[model samples]
Target: MDWGQIFNSTAGWLFSPTTIAYALAATGLAVHFGYAGLLNFGMAGFMAIGAYGYAISILTFGLPWWAAMFVSILGAVVFALILGIPTLRLRADYLAIVTIAAAEIVRLLFTTQVFDEYTNSADGLSGYHQGFRDANPFPEGTYGFGPWTYNQNELWVRVFGVILLAIAVLAVWLLMRSPWGRVLKGIREDEDAVRALGKNVFSFKMQALIIGGIMGALGGVVFALPSAVVPATYTTSLTFFIWTILLLGGAATVFGPALGALIFWVIMAFLDNVLPAMAAVGWLPMTPIQAGTLRFILVGVALMLLVAFRPQGILGNKRELTFVK
Candidate 1:
């Protein structure tokens, strides 16, 4: 039960690439539900397409990183269009139903044996990061301060992830302040009113869907940067986790989701470390397996308290924005 060890582990998440990736995905979710009021519950699917599309493009098609990234983006755009075309004009719940089903469908397809040659049949894809690695700016060495240090590759991913998150936050912030963003928020508040003002509500929803899906796809690429792309990684639980991150931060505001992502991971890290230590020290009457499960149970209780006390979240203001309906 070393306090220093737990602190180091918890602090590492402050600049974690995975956390940054989740932040980016949550930011996309913010754009979808916060600003656009679209019930897109399948962000995991978009992320899956992005990860698999990029990986397959590199491993199967022999494409470079840039080309592979483009392929992933294309895949996301096509997914958004397909998901939105038949449902954008209908009630928002339909989009949610379609997105959740579509996400599961994508996951199952990857898990099936039919596309084992391409998708590897749930074993996932890897060994395609060389092109991006060859472009690393940092020399081969450990970097950063104590308790926050990382190898050159890890540092590269962090630098790249932060730059991407900054660009996304800037883009979302700027977009939310523009005329188009205004309409999206207006639609969120009252779509029929925006429709009465002669704006094509369906068109705006489609645009938001595509933009958010592309962001999720890009986030997916970042998420799968250091690891293999597994179907299990793109589960409905992941989407729910992103939603929790979005709500933990300010949903309607830019950067909130990323901040929320950071906080969420930090809390989880703390629980992961502290709970095990407590169990080891006999402070908690629990086995190793029980300790692992307890962390999430504690997180659930904390979330319930947060929702009950401050549903607006850390950076969120105006409780009305928390209501999706």
Candidate 2:
């Protein structure tokens, strides 16, 4: 059991690109399920669109990185409109069912051979990194120390992810403090009452869905920044992970989702390292393969416990989140 190696790996995830991406996505989830009381289960679909949109724009249209990102945002907006127009008025549970199914449909479409010319047909897309790499301001050198060390390009991706996350957090903070944010909260508490007050509940819900979807899109961009766009990466499990992060931090709080992402990944990283190490050292009664898979079981159990006992999450106010009717 190499404690040093485990610690180094765990520390690396402290500010990894993956953590930043999850933070951004979880913040969007907070906007949906936290402040707006929307049960959105299709965030994975938005992320898939963002990633593939950016990739296709670059590979097919020869668009610049920034422009490709913009196209991704537009794709998310269009997806939001398509998803929200007919579904926002449905009950929350129904919306969840529709969203989860819709996300699967999006994934399957990407996997299908119909768009193999662009999508690569489940082989996933790559070679889209050059445009983003060209924009890197970090010179060609190693940066940071210990587990945080990375080449210039890696550092650039982390910095870019952090900047996007910061902007998202700031934006959500400001919005949640405004009158519009208040209305979202009102609708979350009771949409019928807000509608009776002459507010367009559907419009507000649609707006929230769009905003949250944009956040999910940005998360996808950040995720694609450091790696290829793989269809398998944008499954329902990804949405569940984002939800876990949001719920772990605090649904309605501005910094909760980011905090949750950091903690969640750190824990996962720790388990990923320690579990296998324990099994290898004969400390655990399992093979390394089994130990590696046990982390997911542990995470599931932890989530169940959190929902049962601390549904408000680490930073959440119990009154701000209601898991039960």
Candidate 3:
């Protein structure tokens, strides 16, 4: 077992575009489920829209990168309205069921053959990232040390992802500190109480949904960075992973999601290498394939333990409003 390999792999996650994307998505989850008392189990749908919207805009209409981004945001807005208009007035559990179903529907729609010309059916979309690459300002060279290093193209994706994640975290922090943020918290605690005080609970919920969905959409774009947007990539498992990230970090805290993202990926990366190495060295009773599966089992057990011991998360305050729905 090579300890050096494990550490290098962990460090590689520090600059991982996927890490940045998950952090942003988790932050968006924090906004919806943690702060707004909405049970949004379909964030994956929003992310799929973001990536697919951007891809379709660029591929079908020859849109620029900025315009593609705009189309993505618009798609998220429309999705939020569609999902929220009827369900926001019903039980929160209804929203959860609707969202999870909606996410699957979106993924399936992309997989259908009817729009093969536009969506490419199950083959997914590629060659849409030229605009992003064209905007890269970095010089042609390798950067970083050992396995943590990347060439200019890869570095550009990481840089773009990091900048977007930073902007998202800052925006969430500012919003949660304002009066509007207070109302969100209030709704989370008890929407009836807020409604009695003349606040439009449904409207507030819709706004939060749209804002959080837009953030998830941005996260989707980052997740597609340096890679193609495949229909299978936006699975419901992705939403659960984002939830784990949000819960691991303090869901209501500003920096918790980002920090949790770093910890989660770094730990996963370390386990990926270390467990396989241990299996190969006969230190573990399992084969390399089994070790790969064991890592997730371990992470799941760890998450369960955290939930029992620190329900508020690493940075969450015991007094802060939590997601009870």
**Which digits, one per residue and each the tens of the lDDT, describe model 1 over residues 269-299?**
9988888788887989997568977988887
Highest-scoring model, lDDT: 2
The residue ranges of model 3 lying beyond 4 angstroms of the native Cα positions read: 323-325
Better of 1 and 2 by lDDT: 2
The local lDDT score (0 to 100) that residue 250 gets in candidate 1 is 75
* TM-score of candidate 3 relative to the true fold: 0.97
Instruction: Give the whole-model CA lDDT for all candidates, comma-separated.
Output: 0.89, 0.93, 0.89
- Model 1 residue 272 distance off true place after TM-score fit, in angstroms: 0.8
Q: Give me the displacement of residue 41 in model 3, in angstroms.
A: 1.1
- As a TM-score, model 1 comes out at 0.97
Q: Taking the tens digit of each residue's C-alpha lDDT, what string does model 2 give over 299-324?
A: 99999999889888998888887664
lDDT tens per residue, model 3, 57-94:
99999999889999999999999999899888878788
Best by TM-score: 2
Could you tell me which 10 consecutive residues in candidate 1 have the lowest summed lDDT? Answer: 316-325
